[model samples]
Target: MTMFRTLYGMLALCTLLLAPRTLPAQAAESLRTAEGTQRALPRAPRLPRTAFLENRTLVAAQLSPAGDAVAYLREKKDSRGLWLLPAGGGNARMLVGSTQADQLMWSRDGRWLFLRASRVLSIVGVDGRTGVRVPLGGTERRRVMKLDTSQPAAVLLGERVRAGTGERWRIVRMDARGQRTLLREDAHWIHDVALDAQGRIVALARFEGDHDALYRVRPDGTLREVLRLRPMDRLDLLGMQADGSLLMAGNPGGNFRRVMRLDANDRLQTLHQDPRGEADLDEVVIDPRTQQPLAASYRSTVAATYGIGDAQAVVADIARKLPDRDIGLQAGSGPYARWLVSERAPTLRDPRWYLYDPRNGNLRRILDDPGITANAPKEATLAPKIAIDYTASDGMRVHGFLLLPPGVDPARAPLVAQVHGGPINHFRAGYDGIAQFLANRGYVVFQSNFRGSTGHGRSYTFASNGDYGNGRVQQDIVEGVRWLLAQGIGDADRVGIVGHSFGGYSTLLGLTFQPELFKVGVAGAPPADLGWSMRWLVEAGDQGDLPDRSLRHTLQALSLDATDRATYTRLHAQSPLVNAGKLQRPLVIIAGGADRTVAIREVIHYTATLKALGRPLTLLVEPGGAHSPVDPIPREAYIFAMETMLQRHLGSPAPEPPGQRLRAYLRENLRLAGPEFAEFSSHQRRNPLLTDNSDAQE
Candidate 1:
């Protein structure tokens, strides 16, 4: 998974799905949810509730340019501190107190760390005594193009400058010695940049609305268009190869992205395309020193970057040594050099950093970030996530994960198929908070990367062809659940579905279309009608969350065309709101009143219609909650309400009675409690903060 999706789960989903699996009950102040649950399934859970919600170590390790010392960041006293770990295993010392560091890179001579916090870039001395702030020039934002660590101690930057009548990007070079030089400028918005070994700009990718183009910078100061992609296609320039050709990964005229080399003559040469032709060129790790790619892999957690040139052999060796492990490349001084690597071993369950010495072909475990490792449940208490794939009804292969309930038999335990947010994003075999929490709750958890999910390739992501409502996308999820059931992985009569955003919509679709298959559902911020949602996305203009026209292009590329009458009708006919009366199974929808993604008005309308039709539906409308409801009270309510809903319908663990804070908030926000929320509504209303008081408002 990408960092953006990881952050979305943390901030937006809050601690709702990320309910920590605690140790005993040191901090189990449950929403009457993850923390304070007091019930047993076949038996009490081995790992407490808070274990899954534990925070990760907010630290990163970087191999210094000399490759003899490792510079790492650690969270200390609410601020970040820079520390140096000796490569030869000696005492690590704090170099300085760095507050709120967003991005950082070591200068060539290892004398300073150029750290960027927001718009200000400061070069802090490694000696802990000197600090120099690099002044910036631009309209409002000055983004770092590349941390040019080659020579002359300079950094490449892109400044959005005001042109004659519009805005353009002015690429400039800023040195540690307090000097700046204008390299070149571009008319379109620059998204990707690459530099040659000598620190000269080789090629860059720019975007104008949905159209993207990659240009090669000539020595005479002119840009020659090398490759251009249509709105429906994708393209990315990785780096400059040692032979001066630009290494790129894109789906120029095809559905799947492949690794290629664009020479000085603009001729394209295929490097590696998935030999099986089933997966995309997922992620590329570039060498900072040479700006050339080290490796590429299809899975988000790549076992290794084993598809480049010289760096391929080194990574392939590492892969051979650590087979079945997610060996992701972290940092290295130059190409074919010592690397700071991150390995996600099954035993660890979480990624651990290591210093890999290519000379000796050995990996030495280094100091970890320690946030999750220090607080996670013991290995015996937790079960490993098993990666599995099965063929769908259409004969196309589908991949997913299964996290069986600790100590619960697959044939006897309840099943909860948890869906991911982006219909395009896929689940990797690693730490998944929602699946872990649900499995800990004594339910067999299933997460499937349906047909439209990414990672497989461009064709895989767009395969559903805007059929999210009831087509292959929906069938993929249902087929996965059925496949697991046939394997005796879950109790047939006690299966439920849950998710957020698009996953939320999938949950709704599962209950409406597969009522007998899914006994209950819990949806968060679900857009009741996919057709309306797509139209609203394109017609409402840009929300400024992403680049201009990025969202529109994504919708268009996915085949969701609001202008097409037939396409809109098909999406509308399959939508849950259009067929709400078919949903006889129990469902509890937790919605954010302030959610712009799924308008609160539509949710209210759907709930009101369900109430009129006497459907078993409950709605919790959080007035202050945004799309993800990061707030503590609202997030707690989501898990608590869903837990209660499932417990009532699927015979899962019964939630503990509500606390004062939760009761007050629920009493006010439970717009329609049907049968699922009747237990929570019966909680005593004698709390002091039951009114429009501080606790209730929170």
Candidate 2:
């Protein structure tokens, strides 16, 4: 899920519930005559830019184990603080005075709340009266792997240590008293450690060349190889079950992942699998006390859950009663459960925390997001995404989601091919703000899950391993657009391409290699040169601080390597920087000033090259932004710039005039390197903020 999707859910819930009522009944009746002939309604009004970009008032909320109190992180203006509220619903009092603390977790006994701030792990009392920070030695990074809430004080941690040659992983156990003990050490790269009910490390997973090896730890500390996955298979440990077996999700011989149990004898027993082959078991709900699987969820077109036993079935029944929402087991155990459910279809909005007490057959709403509800459009106005499949030019079946603007003529609607970031990541059915924002502005959006995308199976994911830019992956996207145009759903002359990260790379490829296809291109933090990115990864591995072996191996899997001359040449040939002269369409490139993944230098070089070629390009540099623009300022600015660019190139209807916040962001963030920036600024100046009586012109 995108960061915006998660943050939008955390906003004030009252805004959602108190949103203005739908069009009046008298207005609706007047639209239709006495003979019941319907009249076409005016297009929905455009919401303020702040409605889509601002941080939620409430950042995060979590219910305590015993359900007596709820701890939440609240954001106001520039600062965020932690607060605790009684479960009965009253004013919340400040707990953590500092705004730096986040990722709140409660101790099993509900005595302490664990939080991380400035790379330090600290705990605060439930009463918000006392607290202590765990003393971590040196600057080496350490991560808390597992908090055995059952043990209350014991926390399993992964610490990096210098070994004979490369860096190794050591498992350390710490108590609330700040006492630390070295539990286990491994020469291999340990990814995760699982503890049994007794708080003993029973299993540890190590990353090998292509697959992960699961090792079982005996009482005497001897290691035994229990389960090893195939090249493309993956196993995620859910923890040790009550019967001393390990519950895991993996695709051993099947196309999709299934929840299964690996017994002490190494025999695997399948617990649950999605009946629809397209859906993969994404998450498993387990009982924290018993370590037993209660329910599992799969995401095919949309998310669906399967209950393991009767107790979970009852909860699932209640979840079904509330249609088009993703139900989550938040806290509490057994019959009395607290669920965090969010609207999953039509438009992704309205997330509320609910408490279900089976003893009284009562399901009461605990907390609701007011901001999301208030900003959400009515069902009739919002666009609906339909799952689509089309055969690629290479005979490969590709999947995608097509969202058409509501009440618009499909044949003439301009289209935006919005590509997702991770070329490896697959698109799921949900509320995507970027797609919705474009659709709302009178554009059809098509998000393609091309080759190498996950969720289908091993074969589909591995198919695009070596076919990065010039291969089948780009063809899949092209075919999807062609499919849309063939179906009379998109205007070929007004089509635009936009994406971030690898998707950004794809955007560049679309304009450079397939120049005739896209009228304009918007790339965000894209790796202009693949060979440079691979070399950076190789250097990081040599530094021996972070685990770069897996990254290096993945690069090799994709036939990308800086050391190999032939492979390096192939990658360079496919890079956008190498083909800057081929780009004929108008382009806008956005880069993060502080991005570590794709260095700012690469973006600067790419922009410089585009300038040298005199290509129509605009550059926006987000100061202090990361790989993806997370802050509201940069995020909104990016959207505002893209919306303006699309209107210019795609002949789409103009969105509402930019507000003060958006206008300031554009002036501050837009880089004055190219001539295109002046044109963008001029366009913004011409369209002043709209008045209530002013008619919006395209």
Best by TM-score: 2
Task: Report, for every candidate in turn, its global Cα lDDT versus the true structure.
Answer: 0.69, 0.68
Question: How far is each candidate from the true structure, as Cα RMSD in Å?
Answer: 9.2, 9.7
User: Candidate 2, residues 300-402: lDDT per residue as tens digits?
Assistant: 4456666787556555665666654556555455456554433345364434556555556567665454632355455455555656566665556676777
Clash count, candidate 2: 9
Where is model 1 poorest over a 10-residue stretch in terms of lDDT?
7-16
Model 2 misplacement above 4 A? 2-42, 67-69, 85-93, 134-138, 163-166, 208-211, 252-254, 337-346, 369-381, 540-545, 655-665, 672-676, 679-698
Candidate 2: clashing pairs of residues:
12-370, 13-368, 13-369, 13-370, 14-370, 15-370, 16-370, 16-373, 16-374
Q: Write the per-residue lDDT of candidate 1 for residues 1-698, one digit (tens) a residue.
A: 52111100111111111122222232122211221121222443445334555343445667777677887767765678777888877978988675556567877777777777665777767677556675453354577766665554667777877777877777788887657888777777777777777677778788867677788888876888877877646667677777778778887767677777787777887777766465676667766666666677665323234647787667887777766666677546664457877765333445677788878888888775364257755545554555555667666767666666545667788999999887768887666656666766788888887878877776677677777778788888888788667655689999999999898899989999999899999999887888777676566623322442367666667777654677678888898988988989888888887777766666666666676678887788888677887655676677778778888888865776777898899988887777666765674343221122332100
